[model samples]
Target: MIHLQFRKVHGNEGESEAPKRSAAARKSIGLKAKAERFASRNGSRSPGKSPKGRVPKRTARLESDRTSVASAIAGTRSTAPPRPRSKHFANAVRAYEAAIKLMHAEDFGRAIRSFEDLIAEHSEEPEIQERAKVLIHACEKKLHENER
Candidate 1:
């Protein structure tokens, strides 16, 4: 009978199929360690200020102040809903009229698209909805006529 024995090495004892670290991993680790050491020595000074003197105000605070100043300059809070139209239905009427004109002109493609836009934007307007349906039918008739 023959007896075989194995002795465990210190670094390779438990590493059966562990992958080796790539060069990129080693570089990243070195950079992170250097950054940590630099931060520790600097002790919370603003990024470009001298470490021997008092730290300056943070650039992040300046950014927030600028944003508030910009909002003041714009003269209104951003919470307002967007304007529906210059006169709150005038623009929709204009678009609806344009669609009707296109339908009358036998420009079925643009007419259909315009009517679809009006219906999407102002579906609650009964007049516009009715007009859109009529214009759609007219556009279909014009398209069929053109195909013939």
Candidate 2:
């Protein structure tokens, strides 16, 4: 069923609701409409929308040694959604990041200690442990240069 309402126009004729508004009002309406359309389209294609027999990129990435510091630094990464991480793994990452931050801040002594702690605490994380070993050497060299 359809209902039609007829309004008598006093001055302007054949004008749409879109055109009747001021320029800013029209612009706002256009943007809002565009955003709504985009959201609807994006929702249909979102990662979890079809998650059957699929390993999310995050977990699958960690399954290989390819998930290393070098790849992260190069920004050679995927755009897929991340799988949830274990508490232990999350803690390990936090510790590693903290050490890296200290290294970036040029606090080599503390960074060395922190990286060593990460290696000790997260030995199950071979990728992290290997990277930490390499970074420890870099920190050692930096300390040596400073002492000279």
Candidate 3:
């Protein structure tokens, strides 16, 4: 009776049932287990294991590429062209001349203030920068003498 029941069960098998899972699914499951184990051992989401828990070679290569792009952007920003000066050379020269005139008239305070304004306005000019420094020293000397 048991053999007859086994024959009856085996006789009704059909070809249209769900197909068995392919080898790829089994490999994927194995890979998933390996990935979980790797994540657990490293305490972080490291790509793969190395001798020192270093990132995988492919991930390191990507990191290097990102660094290179960052460096290139920085270089481009630094090498960008400077804008044209708003205050022309003639205007800066006139301002310097006016400050000198005020200094010669013994208005040391006003002259020093004008020189500071000129310096702030034309910081790119070497002559104005030097003159500003000299006028600052003169103003300091005059202030010291007036304090006596």
Candidate 4:
């Protein structure tokens, strides 16, 4: 046989089927209530407000910002895209990338040869030529070390 204890929900108090909480939990809840009360008395707003139906202040500012930015961009629109540094830069870049790929695949001899070809053919693009020269040295060093 089992027995149960029932507490009455007195005058203005409508109780539900929730279990009793511990002292620490109740104390923390009371502190939160006090914080809300203090925040209300001051000019500060309480946190975790419902955003339903009310347009936030930032929405207005952001809309204005969007219109202004759209107008400014329209005022400064251009017809043609920007040009590259040089005409042969694309070919040089392609060759350099292929050489680097060969070096990564451990074909250092072939990589060295490819980089040398890039350096010879793309002398107008000095930056790519310089990088190819550097990679050539690296490939040579790696190749000789592996041969030993």
Candidate 5:
């Protein structure tokens, strides 16, 4: 049974019943609840293990790599790897150096294009991708400054 409360308006001329929600209208909410349920049901995290308050493996690896790169550039050589890196890695290094050369040459427009291309082509190298993104932003800033 639904109880409707009536309120009298000015001059006692109008009476309005309170709004009531139907049964079917109660469950519809935002997409966040649905997404949480879907992610939990999927393998986003192990069923037995809690993902809260934990850094993901991929993020940890990227952080370590960034630190190693900073150390290497700061004149402290990184430790030797277990094996030689692949040719693709070597090619990416060369390409990144070329883009840096363009930046040094003050060719911000071309450097931005080069960095964008590197990002698109070298999806496997997150470090390079991140560096390229930073460079692209820098280049865009310089280009905008020069235009002003």
Candidate 6:
């Protein structure tokens, strides 16, 4: 002989399903744990705090180093001499004046040649070189128009 009996169980007769977490939530949780471990290893009281709540003695040394650096800079500044005026300035000015005079006299060929020589000789004077180049272009244009 066999007997059958029914017993009451939880209303939902299924495996308990945990609430699902998104990928971003999982990554955030992992990052939080890693940060906590890193802080503890470094003797920090909290994630955003300095270790042991004490200022390191290096602050004093840093102050001394800063003063030494400042003095060294000042010493170098005192020892260095001021720059002298360029020796080529007078010559460059003279050549530039001559080129301008030739241009005004309508001697385009000579003016262009003088400007070109100035550019070749005093490349260090960029302002003069640029002016000479523009004048040379103007002289060439005039010469071309005269030809036509």
Best by TM-score: 4
Query: Which candidate would rank higher by TM-score, 2 or 4?
Result: 4
How do all models score by TM-score? Answer: 0.40, 0.43, 0.40, 0.47, 0.44, 0.43
Model 6: number of backbone collisions = 0
Which model, 2 or 5, shows the larger TM-score?
A: 5
Off by over 4 Å in 2: 1-84
The parts of candidate 1 lying over 4 Å away from their true place are: 1-86
For candidate 2, lDDT tens digit of each residue in 1-148? 0111223432334334323568898699888778778869877544546766685567666655565767686687667787576899889999999999999999999999999999999988888899999999999999999999
lDDT of 3 by residue, 1-148 (tens): 4444755787646324535568999689788989889888987665554456454468888899999999989877755577675558778988999999998888898889989998888877987779788987898799889889
lDDT of 3: 0.80
lDDT of 5: 0.78
Q: What TM-score, to 2 decimals, does candidate 6 have?
A: 0.43
lDDT of 3 at 143: 80
Question: Candidate 6 — which residues are off by over 4 angstroms?
Answer: 1-84
Please tell me which predicted candidate would have the highest lDDT against the true structure: 6
The C-alpha lDDT values of all candidates are 0.77, 0.81, 0.80, 0.82, 0.78, 0.83
On residues 42-130, what C-alpha lDDT tens digit does candidate 6 reach at each position?
A: 86766456556575568889999999999989877755565565879779989999999999999999999999999999988888999
- Tell me how candidate 4 scores on lDDT: 0.82
Candidate number that wins on TM-score, 2 or 3: 2
Rank order (by lDDT, best first): 6, 4, 2, 3, 5, 1
Could you tell me which 10 consecutive residues in candidate 5 have the lowest summed lDDT? 1-10
Model 3 CA RMSD to the hidden true structure, in angstroms: 19.1
Residue 13 of model 5 has an lDDT of: 33
lDDT by residue (1-148, candidate 1, tens digit) is 0111222334555455555579999799888778878878987544665655467768999999999999897886556786465453787889888987887787899999999988888866777788788878878887998899
What is the per-residue lDDT of model 4 for residues 84-144, given as tens digits with 9 covering 90 to 100? 5665787788889999999999999999999999988987887788888898999999988
Model 1 gets an lDDT of 0.77
Query: Candidate 5, residues 1-148: lDDT per residue as tens digits?
Result: 1222222224323323344567555445435467668777885854565766675568888899999899779776666777667888888888999999999999998898889889888899898999899999999999999999
Model 3, residue 15: C-alpha shift (Å): 99
